[model samples]
Structures are given as C-alpha cells and as structure tokens.
Target: MSPEPQATLELQRTLVLVLDLCGTFAFAVSGATAAVRRHLDIFGVLVVSFAASTFGGISRDVLIGATPPAAIEDWRYLAVAIAAGVVTFFWSPLVERLRNPVRLLDAVGLAFFAVAGTEKALAFGLSPLMAALMGMLTGIGGGMARDVLLADVPVVLRADLYAVAALVGAGIVVGGHLLGLPVVATAVAGGLACFALRLLALRRGWRLPVAGGAPPPDGDA
Candidate 1:
C-alpha cells in the first residue's frame, strides 16, 4: 500500500481501538454502578463489570471469525474494565449523585460500541445490512448481560429508542462508507447521532407503541 493509504488505515485502526476502549470503560462503570445499587460485593461488582464491558465485543469478534477476540488478546481491555469497576465501587455515592448515571454511561457506551462494531464488521467483509445489525448487537449485548446478571429485563427490550438508536448510528456509519465519506468524520457523526437519540428518548419519554396499545413498561436503565 502507498504511504498515504497505510497511514489512513493505521489512523482508522487507532480510532476504532479508542472507541472500543471508551465503550468498555463506560459500560464497566455502569455495570459496577448497578452492582453497587444491588448491594453486590466487590468481587461481584468486578465480575459484572468485566462481563458487561467485554461480552459484546467478544461476541462480535467471534461472529466475524476473529478468533481470540481483541478483548481477550489484549490486556488493556481487562485493565480498563477493572479500573472502571474499582473506581465505581469505591465512589458509588459520587456516581449515584449524577442524574441517572447508569443510563448516561450506558448511552455513551452504546454510541461508542455501535460505531466501533460497525467499522469492524465492515472491515471483516460483511455486508452493510449485517454489519449494521452487528453494530446494534454490540451496543445492546453488554446491557443485556448486565441486566440478566442482575435478574432484570434488559433495557434495550424495554427502554425508549435504545436499540433503534444503535441501528440509526450503525446505519449512518454504513451509509458514509458506501458514499465514500471520511472514516473518522462518519464515526463521530454516528456516535453523536446515537448518543443524542438516546438522551432525547429519555427526556421526551419516546418509545414504540406497545402490544394491545398498553403502556410500555417503565425502563429502569
């Protein structure tokens, strides 16, 4: 490859890595917060944090045939999750003081993971449709795992615009790729789109219509 192309590829990889790590940390914190809320012990908090941070990425990699996922191969992923977990555990009161800190952190993680997962799926030669779905899965998988571990329904299934926001963000990234747009710009735009949608849904109480026109259950996330 030419120097320019190589440099661009390197930069894209770095961007993806940063996004993945950011998502990991954010989700880890959210998971730890939830654990603390449930009165889990420190070890339980760390376990939940690790599961919530890495499970989605691990699933994505396995589906794409990337054996030994980056989360497993890289020590940084583990360190980041542990650090976030410990911080949240020790500072639960501070985290709790933030308005809906779990949801806020979850939104951040969803955005970052959606973009990063879509990019990785595309790089792995998946079709745009499948890549977008992979991105959505990446965004929601951790939350699902966290909720399940806590014995609650997953927020994505019940929350306002959770999965839809992820899909929209993933679609933006895929659209940009198909249109030959810049990778970094598309990533930022997609992440912002997802995060904004999530926050808007939370504030406006927007959600899909429920079966039998019944009221949707209130989301706990």
Candidate 2:
C-alpha cells in the first residue's frame, strides 16, 4: 500500500539529511587530503575542507529556497568538516594509501547528493525535469568548485560516469514517483542506483566514448 504522503516525505527528508552529512564528510576529507599532499598550512587545509563539504549542500539549499542555507544556519557541517580536516592531517598517508577507496567514498557522496537533491526539488513542487537538473547540479557542483579551486578540470566535465550516474538516479526517483512508490523505497532505489552506477563506472572505466573516429585533418584536404 502507498504510504501516507506526509510520512513518506518526512522519511525522505531524514534520509536526505543523512546522505548530505555523509557527502559533507567525504568531500571534506578528499579536499583535506589534497591540501595535505600539497603541504598546505592547517588553515588552508581547513578552509578547503570546509568549502568542499558545505558548498554543495549550501548551494542546493539556497536554490531550493532554504534561506541562509543549512551550512550557514546550523554550523555543524562546517564544524564536522574542520574536525575531519584536523584528523586527516595526522592520517593523510592512510587515506593516500587507499586512494581507490577514498574515490569510492566520493562516489557515494555524489549519489547521495543527487538522490536527495532530486527528492527535495520534487517536494518543492518543481517539474520533474527541473528536479532532475537540480539533482545533477547538487551531485556535481561541489566537485566542480573543488576542482576549480585546485586549478584542475572539473570531474563532471570529463569523460566519466560522475554526472551521468546522478542523472540516472534522479530518473529513478521521477519514475518511482509516477509509480506511487513509498518515499523510503524510492529513495533507496534512487540513491543506491546512482551509487552503484558510479562505482561500476569507476570499476569498468564506463565513460562517455569519444566521438568521431576520424581525427581532425591537420591541414585542409
């Protein structure tokens, strides 16, 4: 039976919050790790970590009309990011040793952000397309910002499963909404699907194949 709409929504919100926290932690650690590798000062590491963790959610919240945004409103997210960064300074090598696992954690963060962002958009009475777009934005926004700050090309713009996986996950949420699935189940499907797709892509090199077999002519033929 279809769950009460209100109850379903509440559950979805809780799930989203949990996912958001995880994303914050993962991204913060990633940025902090990079800062350590660069021999950045503690202040710089914390700044980058805080930015990495809270920026995406803050941007998502602002777009969805959560005024002041969660990151600015609560302060907990930034505190968490700061704490993680401090710990990372001591354990940076451990993280570097398991770089692949660290990346998988980032993928998990991306999935959670996408799924939760889509659900929030839907709840805010957005059209499905807009909702999905929001999901994509939330999933990739922080990564894009993080890379730009580091002077690297954004991960989402590259030939990777990053944004595409998020898109597919958001699609699941939209489809499930049409099918009248309960919010919890729908969220699980959407988030897990996105996570799986991203991880699988990482495992198998599932990237957008390059277009056009013919090389560009060096000179006019």
Predicted model with the maximum lDDT: 1
Clashing pairs in 2: none
lDDT of each: 0.90, 0.81
Residue 117, model 2: lDDT of 84
Model 2, position 125: C-alpha lDDT score: 76
Tens digits of per-residue lDDT for model 2, 1-221: 44456777677778877877888888888889877887889998898888777777777778889788777887777888888799888888898998998898888888888888888888787888888888888788877777777777675786478899999888898878767887777778888999999899888888785555533554112
Worst 10 residues of 2 by lDDT: 212-221
Residue 29's lDDT in candidate 1: 91
The candidate that achieves the highest TM-score relative to the unseen native structure = 1
Clashes of each: 0, 0
Estimate candidate 2's alpha-carbon lDDT, on a 0 to 1 scale. Answer: 0.81
| Model 1 misplaced stretches (Cα beyond 4 Å) | 1-4, 215-221
List TM-score per model, in order. 0.92, 0.88
